[model samples]
Target: MTLFVVSIILSAAMLHAVWNAIVKTAADRTTMLGLVALGHVIPGAAMVVLLPLPAPESMPYVLASTLIHFGYFYMLGRAYAHGDLSVVYPIARGIVPALVALWAMIFAGEVLPLQAWGGIALIALGIQLSSWQALRSGVESGVGRAALGYAVGTGFCISAYSLTDGLGVRLSGNTLSYWAWGAFLHLFVAGFIGLRKRNTLAALRPRTWIIGIGGGLVSMTAYGLVLYAKNFAPLGAVSALRETSVIFAALIGFVFLKEGNWIRRLGAAVLMAGGVALIGTSL
Candidate 1:
């Protein structure tokens, strides 16, 4: 990957971490997530009006990606409800690069070099290190196995959509159009979640709307950058770099939410940064 592409992906990673932190600190995760979806819809709706449609070939991938994202959002909300940002975020984000690498190799025909694979492994290891305490003590600490299961499921959904969008954007012939349409699909996810929490909608405060919509916009921009990066880089390599957001999310949790063990988490973040640097060199 070029430095330009790597920088774009890293920026997206940071933004991704920020939005997740917003959701992590929210009082109502599901409702807040719905609002985030609204965030996506607002910009997406505007882009749809301004940009031309993606190729028909890309539509199937877009639909598939949207469906996978619904599952991702559902599992993410459930994971947060059952666990801390430090624990759930690491496991969910850590598992995706490997899965995406596998899928990219099989479907996208993108085979990475040994050094790149090593970098990816190191990144995943660093992510696990960030949550080592939580995983070791999760059961005794009452974090529960269910939360872990949900997080892993969320990871699967992430890999599914990452590959879907990676391919979809390449096929679309217009990165902006693909991203805009993908953002618009968030409306469906928000609508589905809103229907389930219909009673809460009337009671939501302005603060809630601001946080949720703002988070959605951040999340949309983050992933939009990733989609654009995929056009220039190998999917697996890009996915590995993007998972650095796990480290960012860890820091965000510690600083913003007052989560514990900052020293160790920061150390893990350093390790992840090193891993990203290795990947950059490999490229």
Candidate 2:
């Protein structure tokens, strides 16, 4: 990725981490997830009129992206139900790039240079190191262990959907079309799940809507920027760099929330830096 592209990806990663942290910190996790989905839906739905939709062939990508994204929502909800942002976020975000890289090699016929592959290995190890201390400390106790499992499962969906969406959008010739339509599907799937559980309508706390909307806007901007950039970059490269959000989330927790252990966070920082250096040098 070019510096400009990398910078935009980093900015989007920050926003991505922030919004998820917002959900992870929320009083109503599922509702917060739903609202974020709903928030994106309105904006995306609005874009249909203001911009011209692509040709008929683009619809498959749009539809595929929608279904895959719905899977993302479902997995994310279950993952959030399981644990803390610090514990779950890194695993959920970090693991996908490796998978994306592998998937790209198998299907996309995109081969990584030896050095780049090494860097990716480092990233994989770094992600594990991010949680190394916690895992060793017997950190996952009771619910935390369950959360870890759920979160990892959610990460699988992240990888699968992203891979599918990346291919879909690239084929569609207009990534925004796929993304906007996917937004609608996400909300629809979220709504159905919510209603089935009788947890659909959250009576927003008097002030929560403001925060939810703020988070949603950030979330949307981040996705838009990343998806646009993904169009130019290798899918694996894009996926790997996005995992930098783990470091950002750790910093946000430490600097703002005054939570988490610094030593582990510092280790995460180093791992993230390694991942970036890998991509930076590779590019």
Candidate 3:
């Protein structure tokens, strides 16, 4: 990938980490998630009015992505409830690069080089390293295992939606339009969750609403940048690079959430940085 594309993806990765941190720190994860989805819908509505519709061919992928994202939000909320940001975020995002690669190869017929595969492996390994302590200590317990399960499921959802939107944006002709429609479709997700958590929503303070919706806006921008980059780069490469958010999450967890050992996280960050270098050069 070009430096420009790489930079774009990295910016998105940072933003992604920020939003996930918001959710992880929130008092009510489910309600926060609903507001985040509502965040997408608010701007998406205006964008849909300003931008033209995506191609009909890509609409199916858009719908598929929306469904997958619902599963993603649910799994993410559950994962955070059970584990720390450093641990759950790594497990959730670490697997996406490899899974997206496999999906891209199988469905999109896009084969990556051996070096790229090496980079992906390093990234995945580094992610595990970030949570090595938690995994070792917590895996034997039921809650730990549950967190792991939910995190892995979140990874699957991410991979599914990444590939879907990657291909969808390519076919849409206008990346902004495709993204607007995709974001708009999250209205359903927000509505469903809102209805289920009506009392919670009603009870939330103004500060919580501001934070939740702001997080949603950040999430929307992060994914939009990724979708735009996909039009110019390989899906697997973009996915791998975007997942650098895991490293950012580790730092955020250590510094802000008071989770995990900083020494281990620093080592993991080095490994992930190396992985990014390899992927960037290979592409």
Query: For all the candidates, what are their Cα RMSDs to the real structure?
Result: 1.6, 2.5, 1.7
* TM-score, predicted candidate 3 vs. hidden true structure: 0.94
CA lDDT of 14 in candidate 2?
Answer: 93
RMSD value for candidate 3: 1.7
lDDT tens readout by residue for model 3, 115-225: 999998888888889888876666555455778889899999999999999999999989999999998999998999999999988888999999999999999999999
lDDT of each: 0.89, 0.73, 0.89
Worst 10 residues of 2 by lDDT: 134-143
Note the clash tally of each candidate: 0, 0, 1
Poorly placed runs, candidate 1 (over 4 Å): 80-82, 142-144
> Candidate 1: lDDT over CA atoms?
0.89
lDDT of 2: 0.73
lDDT for model 3 comes to 0.89
Per-residue lDDT for 62-130 in model 2, tens only? 677677666666666676666655566667776888888888888888787766666666666666666
Candidate 2 regions exceeding 4 Å error are 80-84, 137-140, 143-149, 193-202
The alpha-carbon deviation from the true structure for residue 210 of candidate 1, after best TM-score superposition, in angstroms, is: 1.3
| TM-score for candidate 1 | 0.95
Ranking by TM-score: 1, 3, 2
Which structure is stronger by TM-score: 2 or 3?
3
